[model samples]
Structure formats: structure tokens, C-alpha cells
Target: MQDPLPQIVDSHCHLDFDDLAADLPDVVARATAAGVTRMVTICTRLRNAAHVRAIAETHGPVFWAAGTHPMSVADEPMATLDELEKLARHPKFVGIGETGLDYHYTAETKALQQDSLRLHIEAARRTGLPLIIHARDADDDMARILTEEYRAGPYSCVMHCFSSSAELARAALDLGFYLSMSGIAAFPKSAELRAIFAAAPLERILLETDSPYLAPPPHRGKRNEPAYTAHTARVGAEVFGLDYADFAAATSTNFDRLFWKAAAWAKAA
Candidate 1:
């Protein structure tokens, strides 16, 4: 029997992206059908914040974050903190970013990535919104930047789709940030990651799909969606040796506490 999806939440998603937009209602239905109660559609570029907001306004059990992604940030180099702050103040906006260093995909230099990260960090501090960070192949710099940024702003954040070293995890935890596990954690070679999860504090752990991207095993090498979060959660539950109901409850609670400022709005809906 499938475990009851007691309180599953997709702390990060990208429903506003075009591939999923055409079937928004259907996707929402699929998410609900799968017992995925809530999802925060991420804002990759500031230019798309309106699209993200539109989805939030029109959909129940959906929310949006307001900030540009690091890889996409250099394209809009002039995206100022004032601009991010303005969009961030919207009731529909919960988090400040999916922004950080990414040395894996493009040839973009570290300087550019850090510049964008700093912008989102400032926005998070100014608005008290949680930050959603993405780091790959640059964990050291990502952690160092977060350390420097936190010294100034002390904002809450989550290391989204965490697939980095134990040291990077430790650094983020020390800075009072939550760590998000995505479908990637279910991979066969992710044994070290599983070990980290075994030792991770449940209170500081969040679960996500990073959907349309990292499809968890049993569905890997295919397009992913929010509904698949259940699979990832199961993998996490098994890896951590916790009951599914208990694990889901803890993850939802972690999300609620970290983004407590948005809790009222999420509840009022």
C-alpha cells in the first residue's frame, strides 16, 4: 500500500516555465492528485516574476519566489536590489532566490555568479524573505559568499537541490540555513549524500523536485513534475530510516518555520 501523503510539500518547483505553463491546470490537478499539497514555483529571472505571480494569484496551493537565477542574472546585470525588493514585497512572493554559483553549465566566471548572488542576498535581507540558493561545482565559493552575506543580513535560506560536500552542508547549517534534498539524492552513487542525510537534523531539511529537471530514480532520464516529489520523499524516508508520515511532517514543518513570514498567507488560502 502507498503510504498516506500526510503533509507533503514541494518547497521548490518551476511551474511557470513554459513547458509546464500550457498545462498549468492539469499540472496542478496532477500535483493535488498525488497528494502534493503545496508548491513554490521558482522565479528564475526577474522578468518572469509577473508570470510567477500570475500563477500564484490564479492557483490554490501554489506560491512564488522573486529573484533571478545566477546563470540568468548576468543577462540582466542591471537587475537592482530596489527592483527585487519591489517584487519581493508582494504577498504572493515567499522567497528571494534560486540564485548562486554554477560552474558546471556555462563558461560564466565566478565573479559574475558572486555578483548575482550578492544581489539576491541583499533582497532577502531587505524583505526578510527566505533565499533559495543553487550551487554546483562551486560549493566552496558559494559557502564563503553566504558566510560573508549572512554577516551583513542574517537572512534565512535553503541550499536548494543540495548535492555538495559535507563541508558545504556544514557551512550552510552553521549559518542557520536549511538544506533541500532533490530527486538527485536518490541516485545509486549518492551514497555519501545519503550518509549526510542520515546525520542531518530533520528540522533543517527540506524536500523538493526541482521538477522538469532532476527526476528521481524509477523515473530518471525523463521530464519531472511536482507529483514525483512523493517518490523522492520515499527515497529520503528510506535513506533516513524514518516513517513516511513522520518524514513528510518534519519537512513541511521545516519549510513552515524557515519561511514563517509567509506562513499566514499560505494558511489563509
Candidate 2:
């Protein structure tokens, strides 16, 4: 008989997004079949929180997080601290954001994004949930703000889909934050990024798909899903010089550690 695939977690995805929502059942099923036993669906806009929460409520293996994405700060209403704290009340709500500065495309709204990011950080602090960051092209400010806030009061965080500089990675790691590996890390040209991960402590690493986007090779240029987490994870195994099973277990344990609510929920189940 064949051995069972090692269990892993897709620590970030967007199941409520149209690309995946249109066939959510099958997407989740494929993830399960591929040994991706858990997923965290992120709500990028506050207005879509219901839909995102619904996806988690309906899917046994799914959990969720909500925040205003930095790029969308201009379009969406600023997410208030009270609002994020209320969302954290949900039984399956596991984290505070896919939030942080994204000056790459939205540099024009940097001021508002900064304000919003701080608000989300406050929520993460008050709620005792991990802050899920999505930084891009705003490393200096990102690093500064994160350090400033941590000084004020510490909060756990994960740099979701981390593809930033080694300096920023060091800044986060120095603060004792987790760095999540996404499909970007599996790309042929992501050698530098992989090296960054390899240099970081294995205990601080996690895996994600960032799905409906950045599908790893073989599925590159195609829509990504939770199942593709295994692809990036295989690459993570290679980067860390461990067998796939060891890598999967380590990342999943990291996920459970950083996402304690999800871990508690699983234990209760």
C-alpha cells in the first residue's frame, strides 16, 4: 500500500476571490487530496469580510483573517481598530491582516496606508492574534513602523508571502516574527529569496500559496490554489535541506504556533 502524503498547511490564500470561489468545493478537495489539510483565507477588504468568513465557516479545514490591503487603502474605507477587534471575535478568525505598506503601486496613498497599517497593528495587539503583513517597496517605512510598534507593545506577526530584502527579513526575524514562504520562493529566479529563507531559522518558517496568484513552476502562469502549497513546500524542503515530510511537519508546526486560534480550534475539534 502507498504511504499517506505528509500533512501541510496553506497559511495564506483567498478562497472568496472569484477565481477560486467559482469552484470552491473542488479547489478545497484538491488541496485536501494533496495533503494540504488546513488553509487561511484572507479578506483584503473589510466589505468582503462576510464572504471570506463564510468560506471558512463552510469549509472544515479553512480559517480566516481580515484587513484592508495597503494597495486598496485608497478605494476601501479605512479599517478601524474597533472593526478589526470585532472581527477577531469570530470563532475561526485567526489573524489581523494581509495588511502593511505596499508603496510599490500605491505610493501615492502612503500616508493613509501608514495610518491604516498602524490601526491594524493596534487591533492585533489588543486581540492577541498574529499580524499578517503584506509589505512591498516600502521596506524602510515597513521596518520602521513595525519596530516602532513592537517597542510600544509586542505582538506576534507573520510576514505573509514574504519576498522582500534580506534587511527587512532580518528586521522581522529580529522582532521574533515568522516569515511565510509562498509560490514566489519556488520560482527559478528566486534563488536569492530562497537563500534568505535558508539563512533564517527553520523554526521561524511557514508555507503558503497566496493563491489565485503566483502559482509555482509547472503551475506557473496559471491560477493558484491551496493544493499548490505542496509545490512551494517541496521547494522549501530543498531550500532547507530536509526531506519533504520533515519540511511539511516543521512548517505546519510553525503555522500552529503563529496561528494559535487555529491550533486551538483544531484541538477542540
Candidate 3:
């Protein structure tokens, strides 16, 4: 018989989004069959928190986090520390954000995005949950604000779907934060990006699909799901020059370390 696949977690995904949510049972089943035993579904808008939380509440292997997306910062009501803190109280809530600056398309919202990010950081600090960051063209500011807030009071974080500069990677690593590997790291031409991860400590890495988006090769250009986390893990194993089982073990341990609530929940179960 074939050996069972190594277990790994899809540390970030969007199960509340319509594409995946429409067929939630199937998406989750596929993820389980792929050896992705758990997933964190992010709520990008405060208004959708109820829906996002519901998905986690109903799904056994799913947990969740919430914050405003940078692009939506300009139009959506700013997220409050109290609001985010309340959300963090949920049994299934395990992280602070898919939050941080994104200047690529929404440079206009820079100031507001920064403010929102700080608020989320405060929530993470008060709640002691990991902060999930979505950084894009604003690496410099992203690095700066995270450093500034971290100095004020340390908090756990992960640079989710990391495809930024090596400098930013080092900055995040220096602060003892994690860099999550997503489908982007598996692209044929992402050598530079992979090298960034390769240089970072394996103990500080996580795997994600950023699903319904950035599906890795073979599934490239298609909708991503938690199952695709295994594909990214395959590439991560190659980048680290370790066997897939070893790489999966390291990332899974890293996930539990950074996402301690999820770890505690699993232990309690």
C-alpha cells in the first residue's frame, strides 16, 4: 500500500468567499484527502465576519480570523480594536488579520490602511493571537509599521502569501515573524521569491493556498483551495532541499507554534 501523505495545515484561505463556499463540503473534503488537516478562513471585511465565523463554526477542521483588507480600507468602515478583540474571543478564531498595507492598486488608501493595520496589531497584542499579514507593494512601510508596533509591544505574526522583497523577508524574520509559502512560491519563474524563503529558517515558515486564487502549477490559473497547500509544500520541500515529509513536519510544527490557539484547540480535542 502507498504510504499516507504527510499532514500539513493550510494556514490561510477564504472559505466564506462564494466560489469555495458554494461547495464548502467538497472543498473541505478535497483538502482533507490531500492531507491538509486544518485551515484558517480569513474575513477581509468586518461586515462579513458573521458569515466567515459561521463557516468555521460549522466546519470541524476550519478556524478563522478577521480584519479589513487594505484595498477596501478607503470605502469600508475602519475596524475597531474592540470589535476585533470581540471576534478574537470566539473559540474558532485563531488569528488577527489578513491585514496590512497593499499599495499596488490602492496606494490612495495608504494612511487609512496603516491606521487599520495598527488597530489590528493592537487587537493581536491584547488577545495574544497571531497577526496574518497581506503585504504587497508597500513592503517598506509594511516593514516599518510592523517594526514600530512590535517595538511598542511584541506580538506574533505571519507574512501571509509572501511574495515580497528579500529585504522585507529579513525584516520580518528579524522580528521573529513567520513567512508563509503560498502558490506564488511554486510558480516556475519565482526563483527569486523561493530563494527568499530558502534563506529564512524553516522553523519560521507556514504554508497556505490563499485560495480561490494563486493556485500552484498543474492547478495554475485555476481556483485554489486548501488541498493546493500540499502542492506549495512540495515546492517548499524542494526549496529547502528536504524530503516532503520532513518539510511538512517542520511547517506543521511552525504553524502550531505561531498559531498557538489552534494548537491548544487540537490538544483539547
Candidate 4:
């Protein structure tokens, strides 16, 4: 019998990163073979934005996001809101960021990061494209900024690769943003996250590989790719005690709603 659950969508990836680009075609083919039929390559810098766009255009099943990563923004050319707003309007660029606060390294100043993120949020408001956020060790700030910006305009956001406090998770969900889970949820000791996964609404949850990193259990510490999204999906299904096919379909549905229109998926048999 054919599986009732639909194919998987890797909601976030750095497939344009050098490691994946070196073997892009093979990577896509293998991912398709594994039922990960669609993927989104996120942009981390404007200079490499063209490469992100090219991958999406080249692959009928792929989509892409533009706008600089917060960490990359400080040293990047499009260092102003106007510059970010200009670049985020490309028809192929469906989302505004990998932009948000990241205080993990302690090297980038918080004020600088907030300015960069605020710029991207404004761009998202103008473009009406969803914002892909990367929040690490700054969930409090991430939540605060998102709340503050909400009053400014109607803009969508995603806590990409979510690994934050329950309070932050609750705040984001309350504000109608999706929480994207990656391979990290599959780690042996991620009981707390698995607990959070249990309560998160199926509709509001999304899955990703964040490839070239966060390779799940069996493939842990290995070079990750979109094809490995199945591992993450499997883990997610287990977390919710859901039928694997059902969870896959739910996650894919969230991906479609959050990303740009795709004829390939809309016209799927």
C-alpha cells in the first residue's frame, strides 16, 4: 500500500554551503530517493545570495531564502535596513532571514545583533515574506524583540533549529510563529526537548536537517544532508507517538504553508 503520509520537506538547510555545493546534484538525487522531495536553502550572507537562488531555480522541488545572517551582517555589505529590504524582494527569495539574535559565541555584541535582526524584521514586514530566525543562548532577547516588533507590523517568524527555553517556545507559539526542529531533538539526552515536542501543536511544527551539521543519532557527527531529514522526521514521530506517515505529512504541510508557492508540490499526484 502506498504510504498515506506525504514526502518530507527540509524546511531549512545550507545546501548552498561549500560542502553540499561540491556535490549538489548527487545530494538532491539521494534526498529525493529518501522521500525528502523538497528543501529550502537558507542564505547566510548577501554575497552568496545568488548561489542560494541558483540552487532553488535549478531544482524544481527546491525553494530559497535571502537576507544576511545576524552574525554575518556585521561584516557584510548590505549592513543597513534599506539594503536588506532591497535584496529580500527577489521573486525566488521567499523568506527574509537566518537573521535573529545569537549570543552563543560572545564575540558579537548584543546591540549590534539586535540592530541587524530589527532590520530584517522590517524587511519581512515590507516584503511580506516569512522571517527565518536563528536564536541561540539569547531566547529571552529573541522573544522580547519578536514581541516588541509585533506591535510595529504584521510579520511572520520562525525559530529555526529551535533549542531554547520552554518560556521562549511558549511565547513564539502564542505569537503564531512556527518552531522548526532539527536533528538535535534526536540526541540521546534531549528528553526535555522531546517533552516540548509532545505539547507543540502538530500544525505549528516544522522539520529540517540544517545540513552539514546536526546529523541525527545514527548519522551523528557525520556530514549531514537533506536526505537525512528522514531521521529527524522519524524521531519527531516517536516523540508524539504519531504514526510516521502522519507526522511526515503534517510537517510537509507546515513547510508548504510557510514557504513560497511551488507548482511541483501543488501539482503532485
Per-model TM-score versus the true fold: 0.95, 0.99, 0.98, 0.93
lDDT (Cα, 0-100) at 71 in candidate 1: 75
| Candidate 4: tens digits of C-alpha lDDT, residues 88-118 | 6555566888888878874466788888888
Q: CA lDDT of 119 in candidate 2?
A: 92
Return whichever of 1 and 2 wins on lDDT. 2
- Which is the leading candidate under lDDT? 2
- In candidate 3, what residue range of length 10 has the lowest lDDT sum? 74-83
Taken over the whole model, the C-alpha lDDT of each candidate is 0.85, 0.96, 0.94, 0.82
Compose the digit string of candidate 3's lDDT tens values, residues 1-269. 99998999999999988879889999999999999999999999999999999999899999999989888998899888889988989998999987999899999889999998999999999999999999989989999999999999999999999999999999999999999999999999999999999999999999999999999999999899999999999999999999999999999999999999999999898
What does candidate 2's lDDT look like per residue over 150-205, in tens digits?
Answer: 99999999999999999999999999999999999999999999999999999999
Alpha carbon lDDT at 126, candidate 4: 79
Ranking by TM-score: 2, 3, 1, 4
What is the C-alpha local distance difference test score of candidate 1? 0.85
Where is model 3 more than 4 Å wrong at Cα?
A: none
Displacement of the residue 180 alpha carbon in candidate 1, Å:
0.4
